[model samples]
Target: MGDEDFLLDGRPHRILSGALHYFRVHPDQWADRIRKARLMGLNTIETYVAWNAHAPERGVFDTSGGLDLGRFLDLIAAEGMHAIVRPGPYICAEWTNGGLPAWLFQDPSVGVRSFEPQYLAAIEEYLQALAPILVPRQIDRGGPIVLVQIENEYGAYGDDARYLERLVELNRAIGLTVPFTTVDQPTAEMLEAGSIPGLHKTASFGSRSLERLATLRTHQPDGPLMCSEFWDGWFDHWGAHHHTTDVSQAAGELDDLLATGASVNLYMFHGGTNFGFTNGANDKGVFQPLVTSYDYDAPLDEAGNPTAKYWAMRDVIAQYAPVPEERPSAGSPAPRFEVELDRAAALFDVVESLGTFTAHDHPPTMDELGQYEGFILYRAEIDCVGPAVLEVDEVRDRAQVFFEGDGIGVLARTHHVHSLSLPRDARGTVDLLVEDQGRVNYGSRIGEPKGLIGAVRLCGEPLGRWRAAGLDVGRLDVVRRALRPVAPISGPSYRAGTFSLDESRDLFLDTSGWGKGVVWVNGFSLGRYWSAGPQRSLYVPAPVLRAGENEIIVLELNGVPHRPAVFTEGLELGHTEF
Candidate 1:
């Protein structure tokens, strides 16, 4: 028991594991994904719990919905699989707020991933609420959870022993007595910082770097050597080309690890969709935000089909943890079709009715207002003439500037246009509708403000009296829609239509030529779509679609559809060849 080896049910484990976040994958497909993982000769399945997803707000927590933690663990047990749960106050799985509840910012001094008392207090509240659910399912209590990880990747951040100690204590206080472990890059500093006196220390890497793997064993020579996270593939950013990991090369590396008698967990055996605004951003160097799909080019494709990586790895796994399972059926083709959304409605007309507006003297970020995801509308009157330029500061992700009701200019998170030139005689109610495309979930800029966090000026003078209204773009009500003749549309407009499908299967909404925006099918948010090349189609699962008529809504950032209307068809992921 004092040894460093991970003991599952009092026995040493050479666990073969694969990672899959339940929050990323649709709840309905949990069984299929888990089953496929097991079939691939995996003995254990790993997942990171999203705190923001479970307890979105402060006091109020929705453990149900798609984020039913209890149900998820139960399903894992039912599938005859063991689990390794990573409940992160800051998981950093490329998730918005790093899986942290954005409401934590209600208190200005709440520091993240540290021993800040306020932050710890919030973590305590979350653990107190969630631990009971998880503890009951621990292996000791006859459940599937074996290894419960501490605050994820703490070594990479800092050697905050106090914070790490408290996290361990929190889990223990909740009666979680399972063996604990942590994973970080196999570096001297990371291993030293990540390792507690007795806990298992594992290395995480995506390559067959013998030096790093050897370094891990040298640093952590006590228990079983494990590659806690072998990144199967990389994640794609909003404007960047999709990333693909070579199947054969990766499998070859995995083979070497298996030969070393090391336990392994595929970083993402099945990379699901980011769905909604839960997708995270990377601030390593330049601000690069992740795309909607988490199709990590893993063994399982985005649609949960076996890829070349799948078969290649399966062959390697057989030599080690042999298992016989039929290659799961290929993913259903995402057939594309066209629908004419003749009904168009402007959000400005219905935003006032959807939610109460928050008024502030100066601009405040979404966090300050307890707003998490969606659009924040800032309205202010500007008295300017004679071709004066208008500028807005800290335009979070994307902003559509309007003079009166006509578009003046658009500002993307990339800071393409900081100031807009005033049209000949521009004067009226100035509206800056800013969209929080995503929170920078990783690197230094974690707390980057959203909406207009700085000054708004007409040329040089700082302006105030900001009227901000948060648009819950993810949740839509029966917004008053009207029939409009086929004509060109200009500003941020919401389009709706009804499409009938007799046989429902996975479908791809092709948004090519249409301006960037979000897509929803039958009221289910399918995530964002940008015509900036790379990703042009949004995957709409069949479960959300009905046999009769399915309701479709498209939130066009700027309703300039090069095509007559957005259509559905095959998925054409990656950057479009110029």
Candidate 2:
């Protein structure tokens, strides 16, 4: 199909599209998701090209396994739908620092999403790296990608038209053939700020009110009008309850937009998980680590299962748009055998055997020690450390201090850092545990360094002779093979149980009783889960499931072996009581 084939009014088109990340759902379920989008009357599949997900490290990129973007596009094309690829060097999808690689914070001088020479240069490198995969698939290349987005919601950040124009120029320089666009809230100044040449401006409004369109027109009347991000659903943080929107209200607004011949894209038809440390925080002055499950109260849930909202929106769109004739199947087939995990190896053993070095006078920073991301361990022998105050000049977020083998104290510096009392000890061997919660992904100062930026000191002396442990926990293979249990596996340890299946199908790994940590099926990391509040289980795709016996492992932070953990056919873990 030609570019106009997907367009509504000589414009690239009003894609009643849904946002779904390829990394969030199982590779096996990609087709299912696209089919569901089609059934929902979605003619386009809009997705943010997550830089971090695609390139976990600076030089290393993985499109294999579940990170395959090309296969994802192929699936979208197979469903006869157009694709809107938002390849953001900075995608603020509630991802850690808005999809910025955590390692980028390692560079002290780097400022993200700005016109800063260092920042822009890094972004250019990222684009160049990703171009080989995307450029060939642009609409001109006979691929489904029709419209490419410039930056995500730029108006929310700055009104720098120069920066916006530069971004447009950057994409063009990289050979992105699709017409370009930018998304921002419907404000006069923001619309003006995000506008560029041959660049369409889209407003993110909650309703179908023409006011937002009028605002865009008043500012950039020469460009195509669109709703770049329609908030079909909202996202939930770690401690908040799940957010649910009124489908009827959303449907009414969507119907109104379509009736008026307007083009709109649902913010997320499916909001995938912010796997690993990829979850980001908003600029509300509150550190909101996105829940592992990014279901986002979307038309499609995190597990790629269609929600009531999906049907409601689909019915509404079917009235004005041409929807798929047949509905996609609801759930994947059940896996043949539900694998069982019995016990977890101890983490202390791994630490003890990691080999020791001479005690240091001062703690090391993330850079000096040749480490890039995650936690650092600082150990030292101090004279005044007995019952002395342990002071991390600036603990990025969390620190656990162990005095001579005993867990002395835990200090959470999420708000402020200082004066954490140390346990009394005659023999002065002090070990400080520090974890980098990742830098803020959105808004101003997004490039702030996370983790331990400086040295760790006790009283007035700098800590030295430290052996740092790099907990750059990103992949599932590492979580499984790095079986050194830090603390004891407590509470009810759910033993892996096996169940035979005739065909491959999707299943939800129930995590109701487990406190938190990660889950793996046959070595596939489903993502993290916490019993603290909100999310309960992780989704396992059928494609990853085998016909024979499969293994399921749950690395529970606070779980004791009790009943055998069960796997069900549905995506909702609540359906199966643990």
lDDT of 2 by residue, 214-264 (tens): 776676655456787888887766555777679899888887777766677
Best candidate, lDDT-wise? 1
Each model's TM-score? Answer: 0.95, 0.86
Query: What is the lDDT, from 0 to 100, of the residue 405 in candidate 2?
Result: 58
User: What is the C-alpha lDDT profile of model 1 across 1-578, one tens digit per residue?
Assistant: 32545666577767799998988877888889999988888888899988888887778778776788788788889988889899877889989878877777666688888889999998999999887789989988899988888877778888888888888888889889888888889889988897676567888899965666799988877777889899989888877787887788999999998887788899899988999888988775566778898888889878788888988999999998768667677875555567878677776767776556776778777666667788888888777767778776667877888888888788776745678776655566888888887888866577666777688788678878878877787556645243254456676777877888787777877777787788888788999888765777777776788788888878887767624344554566775323
TM-score of 1: 0.95
Residue 291 Cα positional deviation in candidate 1, in Å, after optimal superposition: 0.6
Quote model 2's TM-score: 0.86
Pairs that collide, model 1: 336-568, 336-569, 337-568, 534-574, 534-575
By TM-score, the best candidate is: 1
Model 2 per-residue lDDT at 199: 70
